[model samples]
Target: MALELDGFAVLHRIGANRAAFEGISSEVAKVARSLLVKLLKDKRTGVDGVRAVRAALGAEPFALVVDGLTDAEIKSIAKRLDKHNPVLIDGDAATVRKLVGALADGSTEPASRPRAASRGNAKAPKSKKEPTAPKTIARVSFKSAGATRGR
Candidate 1:
């Protein structure tokens, strides 16, 4: 029977029929299921299957998949899906590996050598100025000569 569905359901159907999603670790599947469920609940059912899978696996699990699976197997799966739907590979293998390494190190920033100073070669130590005393203004007050001024 034909059914009109999209997103994860379509992926599940493909997996069931062609076994395209075989060899995916249970941990990765669990993460994918959770993400898919959230997406479905949010009414975001239009996401591409390949992109959703990549996002669900994230950098770490995607790296594991690349390391564990053969190129032919990966290509076979992509080819099957590509025939019927759009396939989007997020980044190159090197970029995915770099992201995995960054995640493992608990850092989100990409690794790069420290850059040399752009302008001044050496930075001078900043000097602290001594506090100055507050200046006081002189005030003059005159008393009235009362009755003596009239005399």
Candidate 2:
């Protein structure tokens, strides 16, 4: 499945079986969720699979390498992740890893695009105004009577 996350293009491919853009498979979805639950303890490595998938969405990747798993394994994981969400990537593991590295190294711009106003209307003109200083609140103090009695 193809989706966007954290300003990155995400492709969640499932298992060895590739599916058309119809939707997610039930079995794949369950397995992917299970893997996520198991790896939740370690966010960095656990989420590496998904991150690798994110890399594939970039225009160009920096290197062709994955951190823990082999390139094929990571691609397989990407497939599994696709079950939960559509991850549409037309690249290999190396491409994905390179993109991931580029993002981390700040070599490439973030995946988020500058969104245009969806309203299809031009922005209103801004009126110039003088900057005003902040107002300070005055404090009031009252002394309590030493002795007080109910009448």
Candidate 3:
């Protein structure tokens, strides 16, 4: 189905019920947003289409993305993100656009933590102070006139 907007188009196909999938799960939202971004990068759709998608879903793209989408739509979006056993239906063009907007705005998720880059030769942290230890006597003995019973 054509998304209502002029520059939007659904990029994935799924087998789900739009109404049933009202509240978006994080996994679904992430995949939807990611796929939306991928669609933006595609040459077929061009920049205008990408911009339009980003605008529609600005604050809550997942909400708008799944507006008319059913469970079938969910499966469709899922398939586009996945590489195997693709979903059985297509996404609503309008929803895809909104999803892109939402992904760009980033209202739903925080930026992911970047992985620590591995170094071939990493240096250990330098020590600020030398390691010091306390000294202790092996034993203490009291010497008195007859304290030990023998001088």
Candidate 4:
């Protein structure tokens, strides 16, 4: 912001208003939600993941990097930022951690990890559990107050 203010002053001083664009650079900034979701207390590490985020967003991140910062503090900051800037700021620390992880480990939608094929058979795992529910009791009450036996 300070840099922007200084640049604006410089532009106005030199009579560069007419040439100036109404907006700044055009980078589509995703709210930092996904990147922040990468944060994990167990995965605390260097700024490699943060760098990946910067590379992805094409904008310098307004992030709480997990270099020396504690996970609790980062989580608090993230929540607070969400509260303060409901529209703009959004991040899940787990995502930030994952970004770092992908940066270090690399990315691939590898088909080698076989996904389970859905079974058309109703007897399969999805439907099998449905039959385990408690059996409901049905009661047949007499219509007449004094009556008891067969109708």
* CA lDDT, every model vs. true structure: 0.47, 0.46, 0.48, 0.42
Please report, as a residue range, the 10-residue window in candidate 3 with the lowest summed lDDT: 80-89
What is the C-alpha lDDT profile of model 4 across 1-151, one tens digit per residue?
3444684365454445543543531311122233355543225433454445456544433233443345555554333322332221354556534433343333522113336677787473444445577879887676677877887
Q: How far is candidate 4 from the true structure (C-alpha RMSD, Å)?
A: 15.6
lDDT of 3 by residue, 51-116 (tens): 456566554653554453555554444334322321123445554444433444544232244567
Off by over 4 Å in 4: 1-35, 39-45, 60-71, 75-151
Q: How does candidate 4 fare on TM-score?
A: 0.19
Residue-level lDDT of model 1, residues 61-145, one tens digit each, is 5555545544444434333333232222454444444443343334543234346656676677779989899888776554553
Q: Give per-residue CA lDDT, model 2, range 84-103, as digits (tens).
A: 32222577666655554544
Displacement of residue 85 (Cα, Å) in model 4 is 29
Clashing pairs in 1: none
Scored against the true structure, residue 89 in model 2 reaches a CA lDDT of 58
For model 2, the superposed segments whose C-alpha errors exceed 4 Å read 1-41, 44-68, 72-88, 113-151
Q: Estimate each model's TM-score.
A: 0.29, 0.24, 0.24, 0.19
Clash tally for model 3: 18
Model 2 superposed RMSD (Cα): 17.4
